[model samples]
Target: MERAEQLFVETVSASLENKSVSWKEPLTLNEWQRIFYLAESHHVLPMVYETVFRCDAVKKTMQKESRNLLQFYKRMTMNLVMLQTIKTQEYLELVQFLQKKGIWMLTVKGIICRELYPKPDYRISGDEDILVDKTQFEKCHKALLEFGMKPVKKGINIGTEYEVSYMKSGSPLYIEVHKSLFSPESEVYGDFNRFFMRSAENPARILVEGTEIFTLDYTEHLFYLICHAYKHFLHSGFGMRQVCDIIMYSNMYGEKINWQLLLGWSREIHGEFFAAALFKIGKKYLIFDEKKACFPEEWRKIKVDESLLLRDILDAGVYGYEGRERRHSSNLTLNEVSRQWNGERKNPVLQTIFPSLKSMKNEFAFLKKIPFLLPAAWLIRILRYEKEMRKNAHKNVTDALKIGNQRIELMRKYKIIE
Candidate 1:
């Protein structure tokens, strides 16, 4: 990492520990802006601002820039409070409704994750991830609708354990009701069945706004988080917030977690190398101690450049959509939507043309019970989404192919895919 980038990471990590930062050589306005942009892009602005705003040296150095910076910080704080409040209320209502319907549900990331942070609003999340049993998933979906959570679109990976229903409109809150931990096609963490089964057997209970809820135990959740980060790291990019989550999680549960067991799990998914890489970075910049971790020797010899990895983290803004032109779009292009539907299937075009069962259900809930109407429902979705799909027909296929190849190469570099 560059000296400035290293210090940026240092400052953000220090904020988590409530430690102040001082530089021997003062930073110029340009350097300060660079750090601010990196932090904002990485989705750690609030935490970074909270700490840096208190540093007199930083304030004095960035005097000309302080007004805008303070405005950004204050705006983020208010938005965070409102966003989190809506998410919490929606989450509790949805969970309670699901529970009343006798469908078991577990709150995953998002607001549920905020509890692990040093400050409640330190982590900002736009959605709520609620996991439910596959058998009861439809009922859970019905319950969600009954509770007024609207689906932005059909849930992808319908029958799979990792299907997601996005509540995008009609309400301020977004909820992703997941039936699986990871999709079957997920490269490293394809063993969603095992993770789901294990979680079912050893679920951990917690309180959210005084309501009892369950989630995967700390060790399982830690492994899941690593896998989640690894997935995003490969597909687009993930920022510091994800890294911070792992660090805070480890800080809170390190002693109780069985590192060896987690190591074994990482090996099962061929994720040990990436897991070790994250731990090394986390220890150096976030949390964990190098001497205490039993990271593999091969991890140290990984070929990827540290600077490139840092760039991926920063550019991958929240949820890894940074640098992608799609992030700026109000809605997904046909090709973009197709890319999501492609999953791990070899025939990307075919997958894009044919919607998943869950997706069909999102458009026509009756298909779940009637089954035979799925083909017709698929046709309807195709026609309904046709105009949107046609808008991107002129996009360069060659450029898309080039980006895909680059992603594969980067994934190989990080050992996320071979």
Candidate 2:
């Protein structure tokens, strides 16, 4: 059965890799039948249905796109299968255990909202997200340990310097213990807890096995999802599955979402402008607003730097993973350097550190000043970035120096006359 499931997953993945369910490929009956058969065999009937529905929507004459539809439907079917396999009792049991200790923890994206929908499988959940008081982190960690959930602290835990940012610890249940809701890297220069706590405003309380657990109120949950995505620039990939969940929740529980309250919460976490941008973009791309949620007067007054956010969103997506190389067309090497310098593209020290000759030439002022800097400044920058480079298995100052020398020699050969 496991082998069958694995084979089915691979086949479905291959099908979905064809990027045209909507625009071009019209899927055919044979493809739908194969997907449905696999989905049913795996008890993933819901996924099969979604894929079938998508297939029914395509135009058969659009031959290539029709083929894409077949593949996309199969992918959706497999995604539904993956989502349903999560332990339903994990949230309820954890809530019960914490309740025994008098610790109040509010659930976020992970499993809480996952089950909120009529068909939770449609939401496509990955990890369990919960927010708790800083004081309770140790207790939560201990409790999670009792349940045999381990912490997946791959990167250095963010904000470890700050007492409140101690977020980590996955469990047998497989979860991410967040000190707060947002990514620690992006959490800088912002007060995240205030808005995160405000999720309690219209909190959704549920009783499971005689214990009550509170989650973000439905409307607030949807708004939180939007803000979280905007924070990372809708580049969540499968994480956007959460956005789809929110849309389903919003459409399902329309009145529960107080637009004003949701926007107010957004303003507190991100500036009002950021919140406004999030709402506008969320409504624009994903699920839409039918009742037309009221925007604060301040939201209208706020200025949006689309160009700036576009760059940020692109950066976030480009380097979504650590040491992730961008596609060749994007100048992957330069993108890596850009992230290494902490997104300040023209910081002169980086030029000496990596000697990106092209970028240095672009920032001519930095170049002119670089020649005048004392050798000590050059040493300090190299030493600092070198120590940093030693941590990465990739190019260090030595590699850059070698590459730079080779370029100089090659330039002399080509008569480019560097």
Per-prediction TM-score: 0.73, 0.52
lDDT of 2 by residue, 244-320 (tens): 44454565566666767765665544335544543443454444354543334544565554333322332222222
Q: State how far residue 381 of model 2 sits from its true place (Å).
A: 12
Model 1 poorest 10 in a row by lDDT: 326-335
Off-target runs (Cα >4 Å) in candidate 2 are 1-49, 53-83, 116-118, 153-172, 183-189, 197-202, 206-212, 217-223, 234-242, 252-254, 261-287, 292-418
lDDT of each: 0.64, 0.47
What is the per-residue lDDT of model 1 for residues 7-115, given as tens digits with 9 covering 90 to 100?
7888888877777676654576666777777777777776776666666655555465655666776687667667766767777776776777898877777765788
Looking at model 1, residue 307 earns an lDDT score of 52
Error at 416, model 1, angstroms: 4.2
The most accurate candidate by lDDT is 1
Candidate 1 backbone overlaps, count: 1
- Shift of residue 102 alpha carbon in model 2, Å: 3.4
